[model samples]
Target: MVHNFNSGPSVLPKEVFEEASRAVLDFNGTGLSILEIGHRTSLFQAVIDEAIQTTRELMKLDSDHEVLFLHGGASTQFFQIPMNLLAEGSTAAYLDCGTWGKKAIKEAKLYGNVEVVASSKDRNYTYIPKGYNIPSNATYFHYTTNNTIEGTQMHSIPETSVPLVADMSSDILSYEMDFNRFALIYAGAQKNMGAAGVNLVVVKKDILGKAGRPLPTMMDYREHIANGSLLNTPPVFAIYVAMLTLRWLKQQGGVSVIEKINDRKAQLLYDTLDSLPVFHPTVAKEDRSKMNVVWVMDDPDLEKEFLAICKDNGMVGIKGHRSVGGFRASLYNALPLESVELLTSLMKEFALKKLNRICLRLFLSRHCGLLLSLPAR
Candidate 1:
């Protein structure tokens, strides 16, 4: 019973895992396993269709959008997006918040000029940068919706005339938002969605064929839109698992209900961190991420001991990213609230034990000094 809190490839609903497992053995009464079936057959075609349809349904997207399940992870889109939309001589604006945002900027620079409209690097990305100017002449305005490593999130969308592009790899589907606002949104299927190796892309159909340079067929968004994401052999297994997870989300009453549960789970852990004297949350209260809650202890020794206690309690992947050394509790849609409660209880217990040890030390020291001053024993 591992309480998984890993950042990516994170926890998923038990039902999703069970159903996907059954499909691997036998899919919809078909004689062949999902792994062994031909991808072009109607069986797998239905899987891809339903996955796309369910994604749009959950987000309430309209027919103007095209959904794609591509082979590469979200990183590939970092380059593919700029190639498709960014003209050679034009500039694109980006809000640089964390490591991923910086990575996206770097990739976009290779295709065209990139303007960093705003950045939180000065404060080590503790909060999302705001009140920045978006260049009017920029081809598009790009931003990462959630900073997984820094545990800060952009609560509101940035308003601008330019097309909005987002890399929502970590926080998509965890909460409800205006999916129609963005000209494009892409995510790796490992976090709030499902397994790795597949990237889900949603693009406004009209935005295609705008780049200055001609793109190869594979790199072109128009080609993917025309081919139904079957331009090549897709990551069949990963897409199937993602579809199952989407089904589970719909059964759990869609993103609206799931957002409430995620908010409750995040508040449980964050409130516990705030109440405990020794522990402190890393990000500012208003900008903290609902998907990943990060915190650290006052004493390094206590932090180590606390981690040991967490390991003993069947907790896994609670360790923070190396770049930012502190604990990160990822509260994805599938992570049950009980897991957060267990972690918060451990934090209270650990803080109390440390406080009691300090008080006992003070008591012993005072009494021993008094006795020594009065008479030798």
Candidate 2:
């Protein structure tokens, strides 16, 4: 069986896929495909409603928050958030942890002053910045909870009084945390939530309409919330699939149960990496991501050969990003522990093979030298 380790558009539960495939053909005995269902009809409405409600329940959000399924992925929120929250004169505090956070900082600058509270760019973002002070007067303190490309994660929320905003695209629902602590949380559905084409935004109701700037109807969070995330034709099929995944998450006993499984999977892989001398982990131990574990070969020349072995063994998307040439194994919520176990086993086998080859070469070299010294025998 193929093992999927892709970072985005990543693995989902097998049951979710089965249910989604059936809906594409015939939905709920309605004799109509989910793809063709009218978004405003009761049928699609129930799908969106459950999707939102499940999200709220999983996160244990209160009535003060609103969940929205929007059109653009998390990337769009980089700019849209500032448009709705950052005003002409106010400043927003940002923590630049990695690529996504940098992009967010760039976008926030367009709307208002952006004060970078801390950044780990000096070291290629291999670690999360700590002990930085958030500006008290800033409109909101924005941070990316998990850095997918860099394989770094913030294990705990920063203590701050300013409103908190987080881009949890890669790690949402993978662990349990105080979901209500953030004034706003956004995630692209493809990573841990569901298929592509839908973005999940959870915002506190009070945070809206305070930016003091007139936003275009489509750019306004209030408008989307007001319309129940149906300001326009929603991504019908994507939302349906997301609903299925969320339901699956609930049936599996919510985030608390899944978090433990995710932890075990991550720990097993990390332990393997730590024990192998040939492999080198990229991120700091404290900052290593539970979702994305990145590492490179100590001898870079062996990377291609290792990747080849992984491919031959049915591993997919084990290659890292182009910016960082290495391996990145994405352990998403739906990824079973068996996949990680297989990967770790492969890694151990590869290391042993290399060591055996080295020993054979040394043995041959020593014996050949002795034979040459014997000369005319």
Question: Cα miss at 358, model 2 (Å)?
Answer: 1.6
Model 1: lowest-lDDT 10 consecutive positions: 368-377
* Residues 13-44 of candidate 1: C-alpha lDDT, one tens digit per residue: 99999988898899989977999888899999
lDDT tens digits by residue: candidate 2, 1-377:
99999999999999999998999899999999998989999999999999999999999999999999999999999999999999899999999999999999999999999999999999999999998999899999999999999999999988989999999999999999999999999999998999999999999989889889888999999989889999999999989889999999999999999999999999999999999888999999999999999999866669988999899999999999887779999999999899999999999998888877766666766887632222110
Q: Residue 343's C-alpha lDDT in candidate 1?
A: 93
Clashes of 2: 0
- TM-score for each candidate, following the candidate numbering: 0.97, 0.97
The per-model lDDT (C-alpha) reads 0.90, 0.93
